[model samples]
Target: GFCSQSWTGLIAQLCSGISIVCWLCALTPQIYLNWRSGNTESLSLSFILIWLSGDICNLLGCFLTNQLPFQKFLGIYFCTFDSMLCFQLFYYRWWVKRRDSQLLRSMGFSDTSYHHHLAPSSSSPDGQPQAGTALLAANYNNPTAPDFFEGPAASGANDAFSLLDPSSASSDSPIIGRIIAWVCCGFYITSRLPQILKNHRRRSVEGLSLSMFIFALNGNLFYFSSIMLQSFVSPPGLLLASLPYIIGSVGTVLQDFTVFSQWFVFRR
Candidate 1:
């Protein structure tokens, strides 16, 4: 009865009803991979990109709805997860590229394929990796299958959530509350606009490889659509919810176009 305060309050109440146990446990596969692999070679960057995009909308939603807790929840959730995924991917890419560069210099191997890490299920006696080459690790020694599905949690400091209709603070002042909310949301989502802009720019998706585009184009469309329907369709709601998704879709399309163009041109 008390939970039906508003859509934001209701959704927050519903979400908060669940235990964090289920939430964290859902991430076991990913955490396990990151721990064992020490790399993120198989993890799709677009997964996090779309996730971050949703977080952008969530940040805006939390800001516009005056729901500080949910907004902060989304912020912390996205940042922690995105940062870790980014870290893993960054190192993996850097390591591979650097290693390959070194190899080119030291030896004569110039292949830049994923085969280095993905050596398939079997091996040969000639000190060569087998075919299929679909595995995520550089070898079985460091598997990256779990890297593709990461999950990060909120820190302990945020565990103590705010109680509704608190008696301690004033029940009258919206000024400071609004300011804090705006400032907090602003600090959170500002970092993501660049990628959105880059996609919006018709620039080369070269830095964004084809594998990433394929993975994200499919996965993120689902994620983006889910987030879109999850929120209402108001001014702040629309801006916070719809705009980033539109940007994401457009970006994905543009990235696809770029990739397709290259494919067509190269084919000819």
Candidate 2:
């Protein structure tokens, strides 16, 4: 029912619906993994924050452009989940570390010894520390511990993700919507780099979930398909409005594949 009577329209709607489901399910695996292990060090805090910012912008763009009801709903849905993800990152990064520090104190360990005691052994059977292990070991000697002991740290990395912001404004000038859409694209496109770099740096994807990226890839593919279909037969402005979503959906696919390849490559 996304369109009037054409088969393409029907298919487009179906694709869009599938995309919604895929994205809804995407974050669950990552969230579950973090919860199960009680660790979020494998995930880059910047990635989540940047993605959340994109979702927020997408939501605002949706409202400004007066997009379809479902489009608006999708924007809101993305924003809510991204926010939850941000909370999850903070929970593991701050709360869990605080709890561990408290437990260490109870065990009669002083601040100076906390890092030394908790730091994982560098010499794994594989001859290299796993990502989580490396994260803790690297800062063992420092008075200011990183990763496991401290709050989120900044990193220089680039990555990509997608958050659709439909601009269907016939009343308001579409210029603002277009600009917002580009900004969303920028965020979505670069959101994955930090995680990618983290995986590479740690040389492992432990504490991460492959299912999350898989679902995200599927969602982006379907999202692109749906928007492309809808734009094909629509007016010029509609196509123009849909262009950002298209780019947002397709632009990050290569990055998703890169992550996918990493999942296999680093499985050793």
Candidate 3:
């Protein structure tokens, strides 16, 4: 109904588009600031993971619905902006690594805060030990455990899968839209979740949010399942949605054991 514009179809779409564009521009700073700051201290992993997950679903829906008729100028615009969001994710991850490295170095610690690395959890050099690390530590702690060590054990299952959504892959969904949706939403969510969960459980506010994580996790998974169930899709979309969940679930589970975190002045 809303999309079926009559008196001002172009006007409505353009207006809504403008609003979205402005919102995207505003969010660019959040990532830019994170990069500048060197950590997602203020941001929460679960929240962002959920946020990214929701973003993916929303983005997919956006691409599918919006780009259907207008794939030329508008299509290109949507693709470009969505791609920028993906860039933001990688950029954010890069920012995390860079700043985390510098900070860890400053503190006389040789630790990398990604999923691959695993170390025991005794204490930290300075402030509270990141609950994210602790959350991740649970899995990595046991030498027998499979390498699922990232942040807090929200889901505990690091799903490294991204099955494409058949609904989006159809002739109806242009290639550009599908591509943008997967790349941006997938990269952004997958990279951020473990870290957010990691911090949430670890009690580290240095890089990332608990509220954001809490709300986002719920919103994202709900949105994903909603879309999936509505159409009864295949493994692709299901897998795409599951990985971040695994990450978030672990975080939630870890939170059961980890302590609380206090909001700081200038975090991610």
Residue-level lDDT for 125 in candidate 3 = 34
Index of the highest-lDDT prediction: 2
TM-score of each: 0.36, 0.76, 0.31
RMSD of each: 12.4, 11.0, 14.1
State the number of backbone clashes in model 2.
9
Instruction: Give residue 135's error in model 1 in angstroms.
Output: 15
Candidate 2 ranges with C-alpha deviation above 4 Å: 1-5, 117-170, 236-238
- lDDT (10s digit) by residue, model 1, range 67-108: 445335644564455556556566655665576567665675
For model 2 the local lDDT of residue 199 reads 72
| lDDT by candidate, in order shown | 0.35, 0.56, 0.35
Q: Please, what are the lDDT tens digits per residue for candidate 2 over residues 1-268?
A: 5345377766766765666667667777777776666666667887777777776776676566554455566566666666666677777666766777778789998855665544433344322323322111010000010010111100100010111223233534356565776787787777787777877776777677777777777777776676566555445455454555556656677778887788888785
Clashing pairs in 2: 158-193, 159-189, 159-190, 159-191, 159-192, 159-193, 160-189, 160-192, 161-188
What are the per-model numbers of colliding residue pairs? 2, 9, 38
For model 3, residues 46-67, the per-residue Cα lDDT tens digits are 4344434433443344434332
Query: How well does model 3 score by local distance difference test?
Result: 0.35
Worst lDDT run of 10 residues, candidate 3, spans 137-146
Ranking by TM-score: 2, 1, 3
After superposition, the stretches of candidate 3 with alpha carbons farther than 4 Å from their true spots are: 1-14, 62-66, 69-268
The whole-model C-alpha lDDT of candidate 2 against the native structure comes to 0.56
